[model samples]
Target: MTVAEGVRPEVDARSLSDADVLAIRADFPILADEGLVYLDTGATSQKPRAVLDAERQYLEHENAAVHRGAHRLAAEATERFEDARATVAGFIGADEDEVCWTGNATGALNTIAYAIGNASAGRGGREADRFRLGPGDEIVTTELEHHANLIPWQELAARTGATLRFVPIDDSGALRMAEAARIIGPATRIVAFSHVSNVLGGVLPVDELVALARDAGALTVLDACQSVPHLPFDVRALGVDFAAFSGHKMLGPTGIGALYGRRELLNALPPFLHGGSMITTVTMERAEYLPAPQRFEAGTQPVAQAVGLAAAVRYLEGIGMARVAAHEAQLGARLAKGIAAIDGVRLLGPAPGEPRIGLASFVVEGVHAHDVGQFLDDRGIAVRVGHHCTQPLHRRLGITASTRASAGVYTTRQEIDLLLDGVRDAVGFFGVRA
Candidate 1:
């Protein structure tokens, strides 16, 4: 548990013990509450003490309008804000200028989608022509996408007169890459997909999909909300044109997220919002804007939240991402196997033995998902139910809703067993027929 200076820890990620997890859990105050078994990290994670302390420290001592004044407090606030930006950029292997702050991952995705829409309207002149779309052009995505990744593209396509298509999922709820190859052809202008499915917890083949988009001369957008927290992510290594992720999902504060774009592409795209800070010059009839990160971040920024996110980034780095991925993978396999063994329970996404994160969504025959959630809740086990903001994916899987239980760094095998026990009791209580 002691990390050495200037040396990355070499602990075996898959061999993390229950004591190791429990020790980590001690850093989060909420986890100390009795009778609380939190298993819904896919929605949002519990914040660690470090992140909370950072935010509180910033608010108490460095509270000021960043980049808007020349006072001492303002300078300190601006330095802290930009320092946070640098920390987050390093975490994702991106440049500080390439990272644009937004309200959340949904806002980040919408910024990209709206910027492209602006380009289609001839806003950025020749530099933005690459992003333009019109009749006969297609935007490709996958059916496994969460609604945040889906709706913006749908709106963009509607605005630009482009067709929106998706690669369908197979019977196992996995994306059919063959269909992707057929759909992402010469006519495709852009391709967007999730690095890891929020509902399914299955990691998609990002390299293959990015290659397909590249070969077709289309822009790539990665929804990295799920992957950034659970995997060893490098945005530069992934080579996508743009990516989006949230702070709250990674043990940071809410109301803050980042959109990472390639510098050249970001320079070409028009601003999604207009206000006080983003502008370079302005007149009664004309206005010019600043470059990338600043261009997208209009008005006041989330100063304290950014500082908190940087602390979260440092905390994860202290533990090492390799270990986080390995621990989650081990627990994911355990959850999948245990769920599959239950009668009248249908687990969604990749079958047992498949590579997945620590999450499982399932339906209980003869019992609604809400009822199952309530049953678990009564037993002091927390889980998410319903469509999980993935109505299309659920419809494709032939269900209206499902119950989801997800884990994080602090989760242990004993907690997984409790969840399984809760599921079994719920099934028996409902008197489900064989």
Candidate 2:
């Protein structure tokens, strides 16, 4: 059962032998095919061969329904599944029981929102009454939120009779945290926002925001969908009440994500979906649900995807998270500087660029975003183009869409140079001026 689990290897990335990096990249078959420069890690990362193999090995050798049968294969499957959960929990600095699997980050966020609504309808236990609210209560978010993060809270507010308030971003599209005190005050029941803005790449002052919400006795939710895969994240240390993210973004298979919540809060909240496997016992009139995670996971789980995600976490651990963050910082700084030098490119998120990631959304003056994307695509540079599911932020920024070039640890300086030259060419093709 001891398959070299539960540890992040301790080695400075700079001090690592060249062979180490080569071996790491070699484990990813997709990296061997160098036809494309993937600047869309914010959407999803390329999976390593190790992760794919882990999934295949599980499906081939240990396939079974987890935690139900007395058979040996079932036990093996359940152990691996729970081990994957433990791996994910450790990566995020949470207890294994605190993590619940959902279809994706979108599913996790919606599950939380729907659970809150259920609690408001007198479904959750006594401790959940604090989360239940009517008029005068508020759910606070940021203008720079992804739809996965924003829509759920919007629905929660809609159903609970609570008002939805948000911290507006400045002209540069960064969260105006200086005005956080003014925007988030009494009556703010929940303050959920993205740890890193998907469009801006700016890291919000999460610790400060969590502190504010903690003091206000409000629940705090953080969308780590963009941050967890690329940065160091300790959910407990961050003091966020709940954190949600997708596996695909971390180089794992799709249809798998995790939601971390405080045990007490989760035990009190109701399940978003109810059916087989979540209940302890059921009568014709009433039924009792399992605690926390089991209560949340109601149907057949994504066992193979969990294994892939565990493998992805191991991949990240072998590389070291600090190294990933440092690597991304270098690339992000380079891209930001280059984009700034461009005549007509208007950047989204933070302009001055402080503590940011590789996510950079920019508008090519007078050119449509689709055209920019097509130009980049023709050059084998894959980027995300459009409103980026942050339509409100786009509206506030006075743009319909923008071209986003996000980065990952595997992204190289040569690829960035390609994007730089490609963007200039697109600008020329469109005959745009600053």
The 10-residue segment with the lowest total lDDT in model 1: 1-10
TM-scores for all candidates: the values are 0.98, 0.95
How does each model score on lDDT? 0.92, 0.86
Residue-wise C-alpha lDDT for candidate 2, range 1-434, written one tens digit per residue: 11113225675555223344445556667878778888998888988877888999999999999989999999999999999999999999999899999999999899889999999989877877877888999899988898888888888888889999999888877667778888788888899998998888989889889988887888999999988998889987899999999999998999999999999989999898999889999999989999989999998999999999999899888778887788787778778888878999886666535667877779999899999999999988999999999899899999999899998767776778899899999888899888
Cα shift from native, residue 345, model 1 (Å): 0.4
Model 1, range 98-144, lDDT digits (tens) per residue?
99999999999999999999999999889999999999999999998
RMSD of each: 1.6, 2.5
For model 1, what is the C-alpha lDDT against the true structure? 0.92
| Residue 277 lDDT in candidate 2 | 86
lDDT of model 2 at position 324: 78
